[model samples]
Target: MRVSIDSATCQGHGRCYDLAPDLFGEDEEGYAVLTELTADRDVPEGREGDARLAAANCPELAVLVHEQVRA
Candidate 1:
């Protein structure tokens, strides 16, 4: 899976970082920033759930995880 944040839609609610710091954080301006595990990168195995949860918990729905379709 792939993780990405729509910075334009972020409200800086901190839910992404608060809910999944391992996969998310804040930039100097306090906007949501994806971590190394998923910062403009692919999701590690077993951590897609966390990414999805973070996206779901985001009130602004700025977090997004593109699920891979296994053939």
Candidate 2:
């Protein structure tokens, strides 16, 4: 999976970081930062769905989850 954050629409709510700290972070300015965009790393079990849920909870809809398919 791939994650992308739209800084323009973000309100610095920190919900994404709260839900998925390993995958998301907040800068000093309180904007969202995407720490991990790929699923190849070692993520704790069951956290993947939580990340998606966090993205869905964004009121501005700034977070995006993209599933990659190999050919």
Candidate 2 on 38-57: residue-level lDDT in tens? 34433344566876887888
Model 2 pairs in collision: none
Clashing pairs in model 1, backbone N/Cα/C closer than 3 A: none
Could you tell me which 10 consecutive residues in candidate 1 have the lowest summed lDDT?
A: 34-43
| Highest-TM-score candidate | 1
For candidate 2, which ten residues in a row score worst on lDDT? 36-45
Residues 2-39, model 1: lDDT tens digits? 88999899989999899889899899989998888776
True-vs-predicted CA distance for residue 36, candidate 2, Å: 5.4
Name the runs in model 2 displaced over 4 angstroms: 36-47
What lDDT score belongs to each candidate, Candidate 1 first? 0.87, 0.76
